[model samples]
Target: MNDLGRIEDLPADYVEEMRKVNLVPLWPSLRGVLPPLKPKPQTRATMWAYADIKPLLLKAGELTPIEKAERRVLVLANPGHGLDKMQASPAMYLGMQLLLPGEWAPSHRHTPNAVRMIVEGEGAYTTVDGEKCPMSRGDLILTPTGLWHEHGHDGTDAVVWLDVLDLPLVYYMEASYHINGERQPIKPDRGDRAYAGGGMVPTPIFERSHKAYPMLRYPWDEARSALLRLGQDRQDLDCIQITYVNPETGNDAENILGFYALMLRPGQTLRLPARSPSCVFHVIEGGADVKIDEQSFALTEADTCCSPGYTPVTLHNRHADKPTFVFMADESPLHRKLGVYEVRN
Candidate 1:
């Protein structure tokens, strides 16, 4: 092109002077580091259909024994992360874990904060330290950082759940540690626990100085009821949102992550433009349309959608009669640390 002739004709001394100052001409550097417009997220929006994955999960259980497998999980790996690792986005890790009846995943602990959103089969449970938290179809169970925990299926059928972890952040900080060994169970107090009706009797034996919440399970029944009540109170038809909080500190459910339950009424929509901290959403019930920039993905029950940090998004419930419900988790720790978390109007 004619523009290229100017560079070829430049005097040698002029180019040498530019090199000596540790500067390159603006053209190349700016294109890579500072683009003309906000770039789309490196990660792509994805969906994992439970119906398709369930049979595969059962087959995996038949092939591998629990002790040898450590954990039998099918990671919802993002295409952007390449094939080397299982990452839902640059900031999160998502997988579906399966356990056969009478099997157990031995107790262990790691630095990454983790959560379990039960996908199917119940009566299976996760024990954090000593508290027994029974798993259900829509429950959100937490296995906070460095806390010894184990999963076992005592139910008649196979148990499966979506396992989410803030591993990317932990690994990024080089704070990763793992104890892939058995842990002794602590006998939980029968009376004093977050699940024990609001009277909250003190259970000193269960207390850890740094621990935020005493409850392991945030039951779906309570969450759904609360959402319904809030929806009735609000005049807006778009969405009713609630966050799981640490009863002690009144903040997010965990120190490193944030959790939300949203209910979008039929024909309503929520437009959330680009902001800091990436988010991954799990559809709890009904169907909705999730738009990421110009691309769109339709999500149904048990499907998941990912949006990397600073990517514009809009969620719509196009169902003619029923409401759509979703559970969302995000990298809140990074957001809080950088002081850049927000929702663009």
Candidate 2:
């Protein structure tokens, strides 16, 4: 394409008049907003090591009390978006939240949809809309938009979890805000049990659940078992993966983002196709080397990495003797909703 006229080429008086009237020429910066082929994403390949973040997180716990901090968290900010933005991708926000024993994070509801991927420890439970979902390593708990959720710990150790949210997108739309509330009454129903079986869902014989988010907690044990079974049953499959979805509707668990569990067989190396949605991967078990574009990240257990959109990612299991499992969060749902989702071979 020919070079477009630069803003500097415009007449000084015309430029001055346009500036005075708050009008700006688009031809000079047109390519920036409408890049050819694919988007020029600002999100870069970034990794946050658990080993390096743990010390700082623990220190943050000592520095700030739960009473003052509400939710003691250290954001896993991507440098591409700038540290101040506190976002891992264009639409996703990631943070490591620490909850010490005998502490409680007050109940509140926010417009941004969020899910907690338990990183370590036990005896901590997140009460979402009155259902107390126990926190265990690799467990996923949802605090969807407009749902009241709070955290409490009863065990003797500190519990930590990775918080993934669509805060960046919601905040960008100027619809991000929270409403504080008193402790919610414990509900007798547990969504995990109601939707436990894979091929079965509760039949609405007597009564049906009207809530949008019927299942809030996805136990890691079940997810891990499913992946192992899938890998065992499908030896011909190159990439063993499972999507976390609503058992009833057979759709993504949440509306804004997509959650998935991926397993790499022993000595397996899988290359994901270049897609239009950026992805965040967190190691749940074993180690894997993630290569995104020109950057490679060696991620151990609990380590997390982010890859920009429209980039192919290669995941290699570092362990030859054992299988590796990873939890992935992506902007595919939002992208699809906006009619921009893609997968390039």
Candidate 3:
């Protein structure tokens, strides 16, 4: 009918005209709206075995040149959730980046926040916005959004590190801006001074033009000492957990992510009930059994595991002699800021 009796039964031509004017019919779509409550996360618990990836990384190094392979990285793709098979998750991007000795990964800057956790080798360095900082195994480096950064290895052995970014989230928002920088010599630019004064409070002059942590490098040595001391000093400790804070502002790593280093004592088990923010973890030292929801993952050094938001997980260090060191990055910053971040027993 050209003219229907009621507004809900409008003519097809009239509906088409409304749609042409950027109007959407809400009656048919509004019924599908529902609350967010759901059983376990849609993003499944996934693990990337280091052993399975090492040889392929080595082979890629032999065949591909750093100049050609802007990033000789193997992205960790989550099979359970992603628009494409190459995405780590629907919201984040995770990759294992390798740099062979004498190789230089060109400088680039992007809108998404970037994090690098050294997993293998040392003497390699990453220069962020002109300040070149040395890398060592277990060190956590932050390259905030839109910061020009590059990596190179000067050591004898190849260096590998975990590359974590909010690429998926930024890309989804259509706000991603990545630009490659010209090849240039690495500059010290007071990066060494910050590293030398590792545990001390950073001076006001050291703060760079970034919203994230001023201390770019959080050395493993200093963090290890602090964790061990915390364990020894306090008997009521549930777990030795420490957040990589922006010393100047005394806040989480940044406004979008929370980075943490936690330790589980030998033969100990820590039960993390569940929370609102998803967490991705990197095994820094020793081995542990991570039970996410009902699935179990055995992770060793350099291995990575993801426990999606609101999924209860338990970490167990069955090793009788060594403690388990785990580095984790999560949406805690966002959740906590929104007053939704929480952890049960």
Instruction: Please give each candidate's TM-score.
Output: 0.84, 0.98, 0.86
lDDT of 1: 0.79
**Alpha carbon RMSD to native, model 2:** 1.1
Name model 2 segments beyond 4 Å from true: 204-209
Candidates in order have lDDT scores of 0.79, 0.95, 0.81
Candidate 1 per-residue lDDT over residues 1-345, each given as its tens digit:
213244446678887899899865665344455554454456776777777788888889889888889899988888877745688877689999998889889999999999999877877988887778888888999999888899988889888899999887788889988997675566754212444454353565545454565667888888888888888888765559888876555578787778889988777789876776778888988888999877788888888888877777899996979878899988876679778676665
Q: What does the lDDT read for residue 182 in candidate 3? A: 77
lDDT per residue (tens digit) for residues 174-266 in model 3: 998889887556564554355455456456655545435456778888888888988889869987898988776667776687889999999
Residue 16 shift from truth in candidate 2, angstroms: 2.0
List candidate 3 segments past 4 Å from native: 1-33, 36-40, 83-85, 184-199, 202-212, 342-345
| Candidate 3 lDDT score at position 255 | 67
Give me the candidate number with maximum lDDT. Answer: 2
Sort all candidates by lDDT, best to worst.
Answer: 2, 3, 1
